[model samples]
Target: MLLEGKTVLITGASQGIGRAAAVECARAAANVAINYLGDEAEAESVVAEIRSLGREAIAIRSDVADPASAPAFVAAAVTAFGGVDVFVSNAGICPFHAFLDMPVAVLDRTMRVNLHGAYYMVQAAANQMVAQGRGGSIVAVSSISALVGGEYQTHYTPTKAGVHSLMQSCAIALGRHGIRCNSVLPGTIQTAINKDDLADPEKRARMAARIPLGRLGVPEDLAGPILFLASDMARYVTGAALLVDGGAFVNLQ
Candidate 1:
């Protein structure tokens, strides 16, 4: 009920953290709009699930990396939901590869989707919120990788860092408009995105053991923090980088 009568727009809501956050937001009484690419069946299923929760939901297929599509996505949601109250920028991709052998295409695509996509989406959402004359919340799904380095995530981590920095700067720029911008820095969460990387049982267990929480995270593990940041409960919180990493970031021994 934290978001009763509110409206939330989420990018890449067809799966993983985005999918869980969308459902959780609906449970909190917010009508939802989801943006996805490539998977129509999966995206529509999420729409069906949200509708089942007695909350209005719509799924639009748009390439977040397409700069123009960002405004289109936000405009469609605003038209359907009347106004936008919360925006979750969560569309991203991670293609693991050695830094020395990294291909230009992979790096380009990663940056385009992870960092550029987030920027476009956030900008459009802020414009609508400003026009509405009502304060709004923006939560970008950054990653713990933003705070640290990764053997195979050289390209991806920088984009995450950029996202975190975007929130910090935007928080300052939009505060006068009553718009809050923050980011969630997630740790290793088991999802389709990294399924192949963790395919080996031994490798997966080793990764989990490094975390203080004694286990890996799931998509749902991040929903609460996201909801908190997007709700009135966090009205005083902005320009914050929340680490939803199962305490993994500080477990160095």
Candidate 2:
């Protein structure tokens, strides 16, 4: 029960890494607030699973890209759970497109969801945490693409990089309030967004070969690190960019 009596709000929590984190936090005895953009059923399913663990859970529908919705959702979660102990900014979009093929619309949409959305959520969460005077943890879900260029992710990578920067800045600014801010950079993970890309035998093989770990990551693989960052274990940690990349970044080939 690392997070006993704590309340955690996770965005994009309907499935994938966000969902896994929600379940893990609940198992640690934290009340969970699952936020989803569109999948009501999936969000509710996560809520049900958390409740089965004897932890309180709620499903919140919010589009992080919407500035108004970001604060609104955080406020709603506070109302539901008393106050937020952890806020995981995991909502993001990564549509691959070659640099030459990238369009303005795609770049705008990507920034809206990945960059602006994260900024708004962090601001709102920090404000609430400061107001509570209890301090809190904010974990932004970044990607290894932020550190290395992705041939097909010219626009996508920038958003993640921006998120990492945001985390650092937030960490420095929120430290005085006892708040900790950090970023988690995940490597290739088996999520619905990349299902088709990884389904290709050749693509999967090439990707696995590049990773020193010899396998792609699963959503659960990141849950533990995220939980640690959000827990008291990381009391002295802040402004850190942790790579849960399974040695992908170290594999130079």
Candidate 3:
């Protein structure tokens, strides 16, 4: 019960990595507020699962990129669960295409949701955490793309890189207030985000070959690290960029 009695707000909790984190948080005995942009049904389903875990849970619909909506989302969660002990900014978009071929609108949307949304969510949640006077944790989900650029993923990389920077910035700015901020950079996790490619045996094999660990990561594989960062176990750890990539980042033979 690392997070017993904790209340958490996780953005993009309808599916993929965000959804996985929501369930994991609930299993850790944390009441969860699940946020989704457009998939209400999916969000509700996740909420059901959380409730089944015997923890309080709710589904919130919000566009994290919308500054005005973000605070409201947090307020709603706090109203439901008393207060937020942890906030996980996991909402993101990946419009795959070559940088040179990317449309302005697509790029703008990506930035707004992936980078800007995170900032707004953090602000809204941090304001409450600071007022609580007990301090809290902020765990953001970044990606290894932030470390190593990928082909046709220029826009995605910048946003993920921004997350790493955001985590460090938040930790430094909020440390005096007892708030801890850290990020997890996952590599090649098998999620809906890459269903098309991963579904192809050849493509999957090719991708796995690049990872030093010899296997692709699963969403559950990330839950432990994220929970640890948000738990008392990581009290002294902040402003850190942890790579849950199973040695994928290491190229040493």
Top candidate when judged by lDDT against the true structure: 1
Error of 3 at 180 (Å): 0.3
lDDT of 3 at 251: 62
Write down the worst ten-residue block by lDDT for model 1: 38-47
Candidate 2 ranges beyond 4 A from true positions: none
Residue 251 lDDT (model 2): 79
Give each model a TM-score: 0.99, 0.98, 0.97
lDDT of 1 by residue, 76-151 (tens): 9988989999999999999999999899999999999999999999999999999999999999999999999999
What lDDT, from 0 to 1, does candidate 2 have? 0.93
- In order, how many clashes per candidate? 0, 0, 0
Ranking by lDDT: 1, 2, 3
- Residue by residue across 1-253, what tens digits does model 3's lDDT show? 8999899899998998888899998999999998898778888899889899999898888899899978898899989989989999999988777877889998999999999999999999999999999999999999999899888888899999999999999999999999999999999998877786579899989889988888999988888889999899999999999999978889647
Please, what is the whole-model Cα lDDT of each candidate in the order they appear? 0.96, 0.93, 0.91
Put down candidate 2 lDDT per residue, 122-228, tens digits, no spaces. Answer: 89989999999999999999999889998888999999999999999998899999999999999999998788778899999899888898899999999999999
Judging by TM-score, tell me the better candidate of 1 and 2: 1
lDDT of 3: 0.91
- Number of the top candidate by TM-score? 1
TM-score of 2: 0.98
